[model samples]
Target: MSIVDTSQKQRGRGVLEGAFQVLDALSRFPDGAGLSQLSRACELPKATTFRLLEQLVELGAVQRHGTEYSVGHLMARLGENWQPHPRLRRASRGPIRTLARLSTAAIAVTILDGDRVRVVGATRGTPGELPHVMADSASVSRTAAGQVLLASQPRRERPEAYTATEWRRLRSRLRQDDAVVVEYEDVLPGVCCVAAPAPLPDGQGVASVSALIIGSTVPSALPGLVLRAAGEISRGLAVH
Candidate 1:
């Protein structure tokens, strides 16, 4: 290719990357942020950030409110339509609701997305409207559902959440036991979680089901209930 052609292609790629950086930074500010805040967060120059923001706003990927900017309705619409694993999401909904009702706890269906765990489905609220513990995305090392998904990955493919030896041991145990329980102290003082893998027909675990219990003590049956729910989801997948 000609040098001019190559240069033009590189510039096009750079523009796309810069625009994505602006959008990613904006996502962290749910309530919206000013131009300066977004510029600093994205580590881009003010002029460049402003230009990208303007283009994004024009494209309907971002919304501007006087001086503040936030993710737009277009992005929300796209996210709502994104079904990475339609069958898994569809099959897990009923089981997640059933488990939540049975355990009186919030439930989440999580899947590995890039380097993070994404909540594909979740129970909306409990009896008193307790806050949902799982966000749209969570750390693979910190959450029980994330741990189950990480355990299935090869050591080399895993994120650096633990020391090499610790990761090896943890993965081995999770693979053997096929479940995990974690208690939170700092982040959610009175919360605990139980998770199990929802495997596909070939025994490949594609997702995890977790229950978020709000209390100091976890009922002994909670883990079993979570496991049963995971099994139901797996069976549902097999049938499809």
Candidate 2:
């Protein structure tokens, strides 16, 4: 090809790659993502992501609302399937609910998405408590769920994977235990939570199962219950 044609082709390839990255990043956030978040998740320059997002918005491949972006009507109609998060949610829903009922505390399933923890599944306990401890899309360094997911990752990846200050605090406070880590009223006052890493068939940690109780002290039996529930959810994810 001629030099100009070759240059154009290279630029076209780059655009295509960038577009795919943006889509993949957006897919991670079911609720939607802002431009800066999308750019950071996709590791692209804000300007480049902005231009491509604008094009995608125009093409109906992506929808933009005031400041957030999500898969558009056209994209949804195109029927792209094989979303792991949704599948994980479905698999863990029953176990999570069971945990919540058994412990009389809210239970949440979270996975690391980029530098944050995404709560894919959650259930409030029978006593009627809100899940302030397991908020949707919380930073990994600030919550027990985030800490579990972070601990599951390789050691070298931990330092840079989350917010530096929060990571440091989590590292210091979270004991090196494979079972469960209990935090009392750290994320929110009057709310205590215990978290365990859900292990997959391959022995890799897939998610964190947390039991959030509305109390001043961590329940004695909550840690074990959360651990077993986490294992059940892990097995569910493994086979699926």
Candidate 3:
């Protein structure tokens, strides 16, 4: 009997193996990794590593900074938008609803999308009345998630490049640790939000989980609930 050719199978596995190697190399240096570093870490030839890195960059999964590469924010946005991993939602969504139900508030999950953050998921407390929701990529009012997520960012990250109006809007949302807990900037009128960042494996915040309780609702429990959810998410993603 003739044996089937295993060369094609090996090649297919080789492609994925090389990709994973590149990612692993990039993960080691959160700031970014140069071609040489990636090649050494992956134990692959420089030419081979470069080829893989170039492909990853073009896919928007990795960003090249000068001679180095960093895990691009675009990838985070995509993951938050539609991660096949249930652990993320399991660790976050239930807690979000817990907060919303606690104050009968609306809850929102947002992720940074390029220049602005976009709402990926939301749960409203009551029927008929919808929570404030603006179009995608617009500046959302400061809330729990924004504050925590932004605060989770590096202090040096600049928000000054935006337009005067945009700058003012973003600045207004800024908080301790660069957090942005905004009022009804654009989404959810008559609701005040409290935000915090959901921690990720590499000190990166995966998303902003915020609670938007009715302006008239007492905020006594809102803060604790949001913070608790943030904690849970952080702990859950500790291994990421």
Candidate 4:
């Protein structure tokens, strides 16, 4: 399709068609595609293609190198989570609820969405109250769930979430295995969160299983529960 679908405007599609065209073209080249290449591939003017790419980059759906753009962290996660295979949301539902009940804490299954963590599955900590809403996304350098997923990534693949010094400090605290358990008490002032990694076959954490408890001190058993729950989910994903 041509890059900008002018007819889409009349149909009230907004700018989505232009954005999709850019992403569709970028997905064809694993190493990335230059501005001119993408423009030609999408059959759009260079300036129009550049504007679309800029917006996609801002949304974390596309990454820009020196002159080329490619599928970004968020898009890559979506591909795994929403396309051609079952995702953590399905495999983690039962395990997360069980953990929530056992720990009396909120449980969430999260994956990296750009520099932030995107919660895909959540079980309430209590009967009626919602856990702290993550809104668009949570900081990768701060939250327990975010940190676990960040730690799962290779040291060389630094997303813009953390600076060099910050990454260095955080990286030291990372566990070497996918079955990691980490606790953070100050993420939400009076709250504490503990997270564990659910590893994929590639040895990277496909998602994090986390428990949010309302207290300064985390329950000693909660960490073990989180780890086991994450492991259960990981095992399920492996065979699928």
Candidate 5:
């Protein structure tokens, strides 16, 4: 092969193998792998690993701090900036299914958009009757899912943050936990939901998984269950 062709082939190999090796390490070990560890784990020489790390950093796909390397904001964009796929559902299915089966409630994974919580992934429970995952609910601020997600807002977004009585109430709830609920006030007078924060790798409330159950069926101590379910989902999400 000519000199130019040989150089191109070498670059291509580096790009393909280097990117995969870095991603695989980050995925398998969320805490991130240091340069030395990556060198050994990827079985690439330290010199080559250092070169690829620099390239990926420039491309915003990998991050290096001190001597460690890990998935970066670019990886997050790749995961979140796609058309709907089975991965989101598949990634979250375990917790959603567990919550629904354990609580006998409709479980859903939601993404927070500009002013809405979208039902990007859903799973129906037996005789699923409640519907908090409806995309249209994005407009209704009085519902359970909406209220819980709304609680996650910074001080500027609270309903009562600017008001007289409601602001005080909202501040109180926000102080307690970024989770809130006002039963029967949301959609479907008989159904109620509660939410917990699912802050993404970045600070954005990228998504929330919720349990929507009939008010009558909800036990007196159900809020704990709801909160725990959200916590489980958050734990499953690998931190970058």
Candidate 6:
């Protein structure tokens, strides 16, 4: 391509990236987010963020209400047709609900998505005890479910939150024991989570089932309960 053409293409690519970043950041604010909040979240200049938001609103991918913006009906319509892991979500639904009921802990089924973990299905134990991380997406380094999925990955693919030696030891223990338990003081003080890998028919671990204990005391049997639920989901996926 000509030099001018190439420069135009690069600028177009940059704008596209910026737009998607804005959308991703907007997803974190379900109700709505003001321009300054979104700009900071997306790490884009306020003017640039506003320009992108205007374009997105024009295309119906975003909606604006005075100074706040949120995802629009058009995006919702598009999302309705997109199913990331249909079989996995369907197979885990029953086990997730059962686990939540039995343990009285919030339960989630998550799958690795690049360096992040996406919650495919979730059930609340009580009316208002859900963790914020139980949302649609979370960082791989911050969640027990993410750790279970990361343990199944090759060393090079793991996140840098753990040192090499630490990762090796933790991965081995997690794999051998078939579960991992962690407490997150930053995400939510006094919350603990137990996660176990859900394997496929060929014995490849692809997803995880996690139970979030909301109180200070994590039940001694919670890890085993999560492991059982993960196994049940794996069995269901095997036949699906």
Highest-TM-score candidate: 1
Tens-place lDDT digits, model 3, residues 1-240: 123457777787998899988887887787887899889999999999999988888888799889988887766686445643345655666677777777687777666544355554467432111234421223432344543444345552433323557544454544334343545434566666777666556554457777765674446666667767767766766654
Q: Residue by residue across 1-53, what tens digits does model 6's lDDT show?
A: 69999999999999999999999999999999999999999999999999999
Question: TM per model?
Answer: 0.62, 0.60, 0.46, 0.56, 0.50, 0.61
Q: List the residue pairs that clash in candidate 2.
A: none
Global lDDT of each model?
A: 0.77, 0.74, 0.63, 0.73, 0.63, 0.78
> Which stretches in model 3 have alpha-carbon errors above 4 Å?
1-81, 84-86, 116-121, 124-138, 141-144, 155-157, 160-188, 216-218
- Could you give candidate 5's per-residue lDDT for residues 1-240 as a string of tens digits? 699999999999977978788677666667888888888887888888888888888988888778787888998788765534244445566777777777787776666565545665566632221344433344455555555556556644545323456645754674464463535435676777765555454465545566677764556555666667666666666531
> Between prediction 1 and prediction 4, which has the larger TM-score?
1
lDDT of candidate 1 vs native? 0.77
Write one digit per residue (lDDT tens) for candidate 2, span 1-240.
Answer: 599999999999999999989999988888999999999999999999999999999999999999999989877776544233776787788887788787888778777655545567777422112333332344334467766777556563454445777666565644454567787786688888788887655644457788878889887888888888877877787678
Order candidates by TM-score, high to low.
Answer: 1, 6, 2, 4, 5, 3
- The local lDDT score (0 to 100) that residue 137 gets in candidate 1 is 33
Q: How much does each candidate deviate from the true structure in C-alpha RMSD?
A: 6.0, 7.7, 12.8, 12.0, 15.1, 7.1
Cand. 1 TM to true fold:
0.62
Candidate 5: residue 124 Cα off by (Å) = 2.1
Model 2 / residue 135 / CA error / Å: 13
Tens-digit lDDT track for model 1 on 71-103?
Answer: 998898887677656788789889998998999
Off by over 4 Å in 2: 1-15, 18-58, 62-84, 124-142, 157-178
Q: How many angstroms is residue 147 displaced in model 3 relative to the true structure, after the best TM-score fit? A: 4.4
